[model samples]
Target: MMQVKSVTRIFGQKAALDDVSFAVEKPGFVGIIGRSGAGKSTFLRVMNRMTDATSGSLMFDDRDVLALEGGAKRAWQSQCAMIFQQFNLVPRLDVVSNVLHGTLNRRSTLASMFGFWPDDDVLKAFAILERLDIAEQAAKRAEALSGGQQQRVAIARALMQDPKVILADEPIASLDPMNAQVVMDSLRRIHDEDGRMVIANLHTLDTARRYCDRVIGMRDGRIVFDGTPDQLTTGVARDIYGADASFNEGATSTAIETLGTEGDDAYAQSMMA
Candidate 1:
């Protein structure tokens, strides 16, 4: 369980997050939706400890997440993986090597600098790539893969951390509709199969409703709505986005109507074999 209480982040004089408070008592897919500069990304950064909050406490179970520093902080980061909008792989490195970078914190800097990963780590990286259906691209350079495949490599890297929670900041904003579906499906599969909490900053209402178990709507650094997808009514969405009475939800929807028949079950079966 994670608890964020009275979390407020300041940027110079302005508050990027104002008294933000929420608790995740269980593992599930959560979507944070808001317009630009609405503090969605800032909130994720704070959770990941990439940015410090001016005042607040973040507690994960018995651990005091806010006070962790040095090795403790690094451990927290390894436990709570983050996936960015851009695939943050070393472009020149092979896909498997990029995935192995997830273990950098656990190894000495000198070893990582020399690219001397352990045999077990190498095998685990390959297994993760296979689970994500990208094992064939292991030897390919990270930059050689398409945008969607690059994102899958990013996901594989995150899984190498064996994280308890995955924080995704606008994960699908750059991809086409089919690619977006693939990325979202992979994230969902990770959450379901691994029982990890996946919190994503999503741009589209339809995507949130389709992929997220719960939706958190933010506006002007404050949460305006928090509930299940079904509870996110048109009126509530208008309030969250600060839209006029004429606001239409479909205008912001990028949801694909159908995905390929090779569904989650089939993928799980293949992994089992």
Candidate 2:
């Protein structure tokens, strides 16, 4: 279980995360939704230990997440693997090599710097790629792949960490609707098959309602709502986004038909590329 107590992050007198507290008692897919600058990204950064909280505590079981340092901090990072919006892979490197980078924290720097990897790790990387249905692109340069494929490579890298939790910061904000669906489906599959926790910062309400086990709504760096997908009614959305009572939740939806492109270009290219 993970517990966050009174976590607050301050930057130049602005509280990006204000007195945020929550707990994860079980493994499931969690979606965090908010307008821009709502501190959704900041919360994930704090959870992944990419940044420190200005005050309060984060606990994973008995371990104090806020106080970890050096090796322990590195270990925490590995266990709580992060996936970013930009698909943070080395564009010049082959796809498989990028996935293999997930294991760096566990290996000696000399071996990693020399590009020496165990045969087992190599096989595991391929296996993970195969599971994501992108194994054929293993030898291709990451930059050659489409945006959707690159995100899948990112997912494969996260899986290689064998992480207890996956932190995805706006995992699909860049893709068109169809690619967005693919990426969201991949994250859902990882959560279902591996039973690892997935916490994603999402923009589209429809995406969250479809794939998430729970939806957390944030406004101005504070959590405004926490409930199941069905509970996210129009009024609740207004409250979360700080809109007036007449706000339409559909405005935040990225449903396939609404986007008009059919999202097929990258979807087909990813398969045949």
Candidate 3:
């Protein structure tokens, strides 16, 4: 299980998170939602230790996450893999090599440091790409793939770390509708099939309700709501994003039409009420 206690973060006098505390014991997707500057991304950063909290403790299993330092800190980060909004793959590197980078912490020796990755590691990288169904693009340069494909490659890279948890911060912010589904599906498949823990920061309430096992709402650095996807009512969303404001989801007309066709109106209404 992952636990965060009374987490408070501040920059100058402005609080980014105010005494936020939550836990996730299940192994499916847990989504973080809020408007811009709502402290959604900041919370994800603290989870992965990308940024430290001004106060409170983060723990995984029995490990004191906030106490890790030096090589241990690096390794812990590897164990808790992160995927970013912008696909952070090396553009000049082939997809396979970029995926292989996940193993760097384990084999940062002189020879491995010189790019002499073992054959076993190579096989592992190939297997990870296959797992994400992107082995075909292994040889392609990361710059050559579409935004969706790059994100998938990024997922594969994270998987290569053999992480205990996956943290994705605004991962679909740049994709088109089709690409967004493509990326979300890949992550969902991983969560369901591999049973690894996933924490995603998202903008679209619909996607969060559909894809996440639990939805966590934050505003001005405090957790306002946290519950299963079914708990993400329209009122809840309106509370987070404010009412009457259009939220961009990159949702396709076809996807929305399909949702509307298949009792989505009723589903949405019931939850909202």
Give one digit per residue, the lDDT tens place, for model 2 in 1-273.
888899987776577788999888999999988776677888888888887888989989789888899999999999999998899999999999999999998999999988899999999999999998999999999999999999999999998999999999888888988888989999999899889999998876787789999999887678899999999876776667665444345753333213211121222223342
lDDT of 3 by residue, 10-36 (tens): 766667778989876767699887766
Per model, state how many residue pairs clash: 0, 0, 1
lDDT of 1 by residue, 86-123 (tens): 98899999999999999887999999999999999999
What's model 1's lDDT at 221? Answer: 74
Give TM-scores for every candidate, taking all chains together and pairing residue i with residue i.
Answer: 0.90, 0.90, 0.87
Q: What does the lDDT come to for candidate 1?
A: 0.84
Candidate 1 wrong stretches, greater than 4 Å: 246-273
| Candidate 3 ranges with C-alpha deviation above 4 Å | 244-273
The Cα error of candidate 3 at residue 210, in Å, is 1.0
Error of 1 at 267 (Å): 40
Tell me which residue pairs clash in candidate 2. none
Task: Find the 10 residues in a row with the least total lDDT in model 1.
Answer: 256-265
